[model samples]
Target chain A: MNSVIFKKELKRNRKNTAIWTAIVVVFTALILSIFPSFSEMGEEMAKLMSSLPEEYAKALGMDEETWSSIIGYYGTYYGIYIILLIGIFTASTGATIIGKEERDGTAEFLLTRPISRGSIVWTKLMALGTLFIIIYGIQTLSAVIGLLIFGEDVNWPVFTTMHVHGFFLVGFFTASGVLMSSFLSSKLNYMGPVVGLIFGGYFLNAISMAVEKVSWLGYFSPYHYLNLTAKNGVLELNLITCLGASVVVAVFLWISNKRYLSRDIVG
Target chain B: MNAIELSSLSKFYGNQCGIESVSFAVKKGEIFGFIGPNGAGKSTTIRTLLGLLTATSGKAEILGMDTSNEGARIRERIGYLPSEVDYYSEMSSKELLLYHAAIYKVADAEKKIQELATYFQLELDRPIDDLSYGNKKKCAIIQSVLHDPEVLILDEPTGGLDPLMQNRFFELLERQNKKGVTIFFSSHVLSEIQRMCDRAAIIRDGKITAVEDISTLLSKQMKMVRLVTTSVNNIVLPVGALNHHQSGQKHTFDYVGPTQDLVIWLSSQSIIDVTLSEPDLERIFMNYYQS
Candidate 1:
């Protein structure tokens, strides 16, 4: 991929990154400020957790009470919300990267340049990766500040592992969004398939939590990978399965580039 | 060396028609005009040349290289202006041109962009979204030519420009041609083509019905003579001549035969004045379409 095009794309996305960063920082700060009271709230959550069936505990990673005790107040209240927020933000950015040029009629202009279609797609993906890193970095920094102020000596390795798992989830969903954006012509069409996949996956995971017999269904949701409470509190994954899924996404992107190079530029 | 060559080139969208069996060749340093109506596949052919869309069939070559196989290399030597000047709205005009110049690997890109901005009378710092339609078109033109490609393919390059700016654009094209650049442009405006192109092709309904030297096509196709006489006398005209009434005592006849015979025949009557007008491209286009 050409660095010049990649840099240009990065420059174009600067405004969007700045705006999203501020919102994320403010939200993180606000959530962290109130998270110290979670210890008192944890007793109630523990009672609520005890009443739930075994499947619900397994799905929410509540197998042991100590899993909630280690992270203290803020972790219990804000953990899932943070993961969902990062996933949605990353997916939306990826979706826009592929569709924005077409929406603005700039695709024809860009295609006319001496760059290859493959290079264009690669540069867009790289730019999106950079944006994801920046957003994630800002959120991680804000979390560290919150931990410093709240007098919590957190386990650095565990915290890092959880955030890393969140990053991978973002990457996976971003790839999905990029593939969908390639196939769909309009932004609305692109959003429909991606949003459906995300919400449907969440709904399936939730239903699995409510019923023990279908607990295996949680494996179908990428959220299963984000559950970082297993064994040593390290992010675990079926590497072979994840690699296979990534290959499928790569194939989709390749096919998308082929179609883009050959398709007519519709108004 | 020829800059572009298309032989029996055709493109179609499923059952819908695009350009069909269109053949033309543009020599180096020549300004070739592609004249057609809207939806006449001019843009389609241009896009195919740019490798933005694959041709359904037929062969096209740029600088003696197959357009499909060597699209990136071909694009390195050609600059194109799409009909709609869509650009990154967030970028300043200078940034957009520099970005394109870098992609084309233009040497001394910054200097080239500066020169083009000055020549086009565009403000380099203005964001593309803040510019007017004509100014946006000027920016698009500047971006296409900043790399100084050997061949320039422009679709409706002056569509939204004012008269003064249009003249300036033609002047810029003339200057580029003088510097040994080949230009192939498509436009619906015949007068601009008449003023700028050395040769032109008229496309109708996805087919190029005629391709000829512009002046020669006009001269051969537009052969109308108007005569004013003292009386309205019934004049017997030869077959294949178009006779039309201009006024009570004036008449116009369009023909392809020798004009000397018509002049002699008109001299026999009490003629007041006779005027021979050169053929117009618009008239030829109309006749070609009607047929």
Candidate 2:
């Protein structure tokens, strides 16, 4: 665990972290600000949402019953955007962290230093994990602050569970990015594939949710497992998709370590 | 103890060959040169020695530690300067230097970095992206030697520098050699090898053709001789005449024998006229290869 490399990575990506954190938090605050209007016209909004096609509503992952509840409202609307923003953040971060050394022609310098390949990978990954924690911390803080300022009543347990489940989903894409970065020889070349995977999983989740025959497609996207529809849902630490996503993250990190350690490192 | 040793080192990229059967050893306190043309496995050999690439069939040891299994430990006392260098675009030269120094755990990293920066006349505060290629090369030089490692591995380290900077860099290396640093220099520049190295290995087509003292090898430089003889067939060709070519009344070939003996033999031939010139690296290698 090299603190130097870890801190260096943190400092290098601070700007991007700041930008994404702001996007997630500001969006969270804006949605929470509309809680008053939403509660006042709750029945009308419920009719409008229910009258819409079930397919459209399911594709959008919208739950009309949860529209009046503060935490449920937060999850249905802001939760989707949160997952999307975190997806972009984690994917790009994971892909670029280690590969930028190779792309920028500095791997020769870094690898030649008195550091083990495992140490380098773990340190960079640690920094990446730290970034996620920081972003998530800021996001949760913003949501709680918004709830206090605008909402009549807030469901703390549901809100916490929503953010916690969102972490696992975002983590899935971040791990894919890490694995993708290990194979990339040039700068930002893997961004297309990583971002594409995130969007693909998102669409697959939508398709599986709206259609009855291919519900397995929902498993592809970690976003599908979020507790967005469960009003005042019990905070469960264990979910099958969460376990599956954790395994995927561990597998990618392991592969990234192995591949990077034994890689030929051309150019 | 040998500072660096490689035995039958081979690296294959799938079916393609990177380097094959490259064997050499550099004694402590010596500057050994690895010479070869591009794609001749110079970089491959160096990369294998550094544990940047694993060997398919052989073994390498640096400071008595196996390169494959003991890379990090071996690198503790090794300094490497690659042919082309790039660092974080956002990092100023000073920051990058400090970061590298921290990796090596240099106690007085700032002072060492400043010393090298001063000698190279590089702007330490400038971002790497803003620096010119030559300036970047200067920083790389500083980075490689700042820790004063016991072993220094440099691959074409003078590519972007001007003649003046090259001289300064060589002088710095020489100074380090005096302090007992082993230098492994890989380059295609014969003149540079002649200028600094005590011994050299000539590699071509992924094989080492010769490893000899630089002075002794350079002293035996191959010479090309062309003779316009009255009777080419009647004349007796001296020993070491190679790759003979005949056209009408003219005979031309390369010679790698005693210059005095060649002059005496030429005096006896009924030669119309004769011309002698120094041969290039290929011809020189051929003379050594054939012998």
TM-scores of all predicted structures: 0.86, 0.90
Worst 10 residues of 1 chain A by lDDT: A65-74
What lDDT score is found at residue A103 in candidate 2?
79
Q: In model 1, where do residues sit more than 4 Å from their true spots?
A: A41-79, A148-157, A187-192, A213-219, A225-245, B105-111, B223-283, B286-291
Checking candidate 1 for backbone clashes, the offending pairs are B222-B279
Misplaced by over 4 Å in model 2 are A183-188, A231-244, B223-280
Query: After best superposition, candidate 2 residue A38: deviation in angstroms?
Result: 2.9
Model 2 chain B, poorest ten-residue lDDT window? B231-240
Interface RMSD to the true structure, each candidate: 1.4, 0.9
Per-chain TM-score (chain B), model 2: 0.83
Across A1-267, the per-residue lDDT of candidate 1 in tens digits comes to 878888888888888788878777888788766656644576776777688886666555454433354443334333456655665677777887868888888888877777777778788888888998998899889887876785456666656656665566667777777767767764464656666777666667766766878878988987654544445444454466556656765776677667666666654
Model 2, B1-291: lDDT tens digits are 999998999999999988889898999999999998788899989888887787898999999999999999999999999887878889999999999888888889998888889999999999999999899999889988988899999999999899999999999999999999999999887778888899989889888878999877765666799889987474567887888889888988888777887899999888889999866666677686676
lDDT of 1 at A194: 68
For candidate 2, the lDDT comes to 0.84
Alpha carbon deviation, residue A258, candidate 2 (Å): 1.4
Who wins the TM-score comparison? 2
